[model samples]
Target: MVDVNSLAALLPDGVVVTDPDILGGYRQDRAQDPEAGTPAALVRPANTEQVATVVRWAHERGVAIVPRGAGTGLSGGATAQDGALLLSTERMRDISVDPVTRTAVAQPGLLNAEVKAAVAEHGLWYPPDPSSFEICSIGGNAATNAGGLCCVKYGVTTDYVLGMEVVLADGTVVRLGGPRLKDSAGLSLTKLFVGSEGTLGIITELTLRLLPAQPPQSTVVASFATLEAACDAILAITGRLRPSMLEFMDSVAINAVEDQLRMGLDREAAALLVARSDAPGEHAGLEVAEIAALCEKAGATEVFATDDPAEGEAFTVARRVAIPALERKGPLLLEDVGVPLPKLGELVTGIAGIARRREVLVSVIAHAGDGNTHPLIVYNPADADESARAQQAFGEIMDLAIALGGTITGEHGVGRLKKAWLPNQVGPDVMALTRLIKSALDPQGILNPGAVL
Candidate 1:
């Protein structure tokens, strides 16, 4: 066994922590894996060299290592392993914006919101805005390839990521991609590591591409009496034009949000749709009006549009807060399942069927434009049968998405929680290829063992 004192000697005084109390807090991430293992040590590295050193020590000792970002992952990607050293990037935050290149070089620990704010000083935007953007680290976003509200229009972290610096399992650093927008010079290694979920390597630094500030947006919020009506409107609005934001909430989710926000949301409505357009100038209003008309034609009981940023923001907040709103009822099993546009209605309906069959309270909130849905399955831990049903529903949702020719995970990477079903979704051949690559890159299996593969 590696001596605790020797590990402490490799890092700064406060950097290496072994207190059982402190280690307890680092054991599990947001997924709250009940089986999370206690790490032998926790190393909070403030830079790439520090991370590499920790990795080298663990690699040489054949000690497992779990790479963690902000511990905000819904999947168990950051969950600690028994007797392993947890390599946390939460202390590595440092950012330098190059306004000329329209990019920012950021350490992994910087919050996604901070990255946006830093680049926005030069009138730029980093568009991956996860609902947890305020709390999630840039490294976590890249690790999960996380998507959010603006992703419908701007794209996810992988799109904005021009380059990155990752520390491999052997503690050797590899720099992939760069400031150049178009780099076909290599095998797209940067893209490979973006969503590896800490299994392939630990991301230490990121080179993010930025865009000019987004235009002012016009927002529309509507409620329909039937799921069919809401889905029809989604088809109509999407078929006609692309909206910067297109989201949906089912009746269960609507009631949950209303119970919390009490914002006079239509409780009788079977579904709610929030749409926005970032078209510049007068075109923004024009798009909002068209969206309102689309909703009306699709049997909207109520249609509301706003040019007021605050009014628009209020609705966006409600949409982003939907998950937490539903979480108030019980512990949640969150499923990030997505399908092709045309198959979306089927996916939602199939999930509803599964919920009914399993007898679980499953509330769905979706980034409708991309057909990605977050089905919140509420359950009580004290009741074994109820918990079993919820787990069944969770797996059923992923199965349904797979049947619809969609991903088991749209944005959130498949961490340990979903790894069992990953092979079923991706097939054995792909799984073999994944294992082969992971073996080649991290032969010691020290980087985030039990995650992904």
Candidate 2:
């Protein structure tokens, strides 16, 4: 075992804490892994040097180190291990925005929304907005390659990641990629680490690309009598122009939101779709009208169009709040499975079939335009049988996604909860390559062991 006292000595005072209560707090992330282990200590590193010191010490001692940011991970990505150290970047919260370069060099601890609001002050935008953006860290976003509602149009975290200062497993500090967007040199090492989920390295600072603030958006909210109609509207919307955002929620999700927000959502409707167009000037209104028409042509029960920004924002907020709102029903086993556009309807219907067959409640909310669905499986943990069925439904949903040529996880990292399905999705050859890289970079597997690979 490593000496916790010696580890504390390497960092500044108060950087390391071994308090039982504090350590208890670091035990589990949002996934609430029941088997989460008690960490021996928590190391709060404010800078790369301190992170390097911790990693070097851990590597030398063969101690497992779990890299955590904000501790807001939805998966078991940041769960502490027995006698392991939780190396948190919560104290590393510094951001420098360069409007001229259209980039922000941000410390890993900064929240996604904070980054978005920070860049917006300079009339720029950092596009990735996870539902937990208000709470989740930028580092966590990079670790998971998080996708959001707008990702259907703007792309995910990897797209805006221009560069990063990463602390490798053995404590070697290496800079990958940079401000210049057109760097084609060397193997795409930076891209590899973008979604490595802290198993391979600890990302300290990120150099992120930014775009101009989104233009005023027009909103379209459509209610469908059947799932097929809503899915067809989704396909039609995508077949034409690219909207800034397109979100979907099934009847259960609609009713859940309505129950919580009293937003006058249609309870009888089988599905609801919210589409937005951020085109400049009158174009946004025109595009929204087109989208509304598409929804109507696809047999929408009702189509509501609005040019009022506040009205549009209210609907967007309701969409973003779907996960939290749905939580009121029961605990959620959120699945982020994505399929090709054409296969999305099949995937959604297949999830419904699984829920019925397994006799579990699965409320689906999705970034429909991108074909990424967050199938929130609700179950009463108190009932052992129901919980087991819920767990079965969870795996079955991912299996269905894989069989349809889709992904098990579109944004959220494999973490510990989904690691079992990873090899099944990526195949042995890719898994071997992943292991090779993990071995080459983290020889002892000390950096977030038991995650990703």
Candidate 3:
């Protein structure tokens, strides 16, 4: 076992925690991987310098380090390894917004919602919003290149990341890019680290570009008698105009959400679509009306349009809460698979077939505008047979995505859980190039060992 006495002595008191109970809490992230291992110690650094100090110590001792933010990652990217030091950025909350430049420099520990609120104070907005914005850390968003309801319009975390401060594997701190909107100097190292999932380096701070406050949005909620009709509506809406948000929930997800929210959702509908338009001025209403018409033309069972923000948000909440609502049934093997918009219907149907073959209950919800679907496979862990079937269905879903020229992961990084399918998706050549880059940056392989590459 690597002794952490010298490491603890270098940092401020209480920054290094070694209690077994506390270490257990950091074993696994939201992925809840059954094989996650306990960490040696948990380190909560308050600033970049402290982080560097910890990394420097680990680098010299050849100790493995796992960087984590908020422990809300769904890909097991932050899952701790036995005898590895778990570095949590929860204590690094700090942010400064520059209204003049329309940017914000934020520490990795700040929650995504907090960044939005902070920037909103200056009449600016940070657009990348994962569904777990309320609980997920801004650093994690950047690390995973996370996307959400608005991503189909504004783009993902990498879009707004103008620059960042990262600690390389050797403990060298490098600042790439900046508040400048346009910088052509040097390689795009900043973009390289945005979704590297802590394998290359640990992000300390992010220079995020901001946008002006969003205009009031008009929302459209439609229920379909069949999943195919809902997919048609999604394709129609996207083909017509860009929406601020376009979400889909299958009947399993709809019923699950309705069970929790009691919002009078159509329990029998095969699928539900919630779309929004934030077009300036009265155009928002016009766009929503058009979307409603398209839904009706696509044979929606029922269509509802509302200009009320509260009513619209309620439906969006229903779509967002589908995972938790389904979790109430049993443990879930969550899959984030995405295909081209043209192939989304096939992907969704293919997933349904996998669930049927495995004899497991699968609830699917998605940012349909972007063709990214989250299929939640529910299983009774206590039942060995059921759990085995669920695992089989999980792999089958990824295999299906790859066969359809889709990705195994859309927003979530390919952590330990999804690394097996990565090679098949990217092919051996791209995989070799990835390894070359990983070795060049982290020759010792101490950073996020066993992830991605």
lDDT: which candidate is best? 3
Q: What range of 10 consecutive residues in model 2 has the weakest lDDT sum? A: 1-10
In candidate 1, stretches whose alpha carbon ends up further than 4 angstroms from where it belongs are none
List lDDT for all candidates, in order. Answer: 0.91, 0.92, 0.93
TM-score of 1: 0.98
Clashing pairs in 2: none
The superposed Cα distance between candidate 1 and the true structure at residue 18, in angstroms, equals: 0.7
> Model 3 lDDT vs. the true structure?
0.93
Ranking by lDDT: 3, 2, 1
- Most TM-score-accurate candidate: 3
Q: Write the per-residue lDDT of candidate 1 for residues 1-453, one digit (tens) a residue.
A: 446677778888888898899999999998888879989988998999988888888888899999888898898889999999988889988999998899899999999999989999999999999988999999999999999987777888899999999999998999999898888996999999989999898999999999999888889999999888888999899899889999999999999999999999999999999999999988898899999999999999999999998989999999988988888998999889989889888988888899899999999899998888898899998999999898888888998899999988988889999998898888999999999999999998888899987
**Over the stretch 91-199, how does candidate 2's per-residue lDDT look in tens digits?**
9999999999899999999999999989999999999988888999999999999989899899999999999999988889999999987999999999999999998
lDDT of 3 at 340: 95
Candidate 2, residue 324: lDDT: 85
Task: Give the runs in model 3 whose Cα sits over 4 Å from its true position.
Answer: none
TM-scores for the candidates: 0.98, 0.98, 0.99
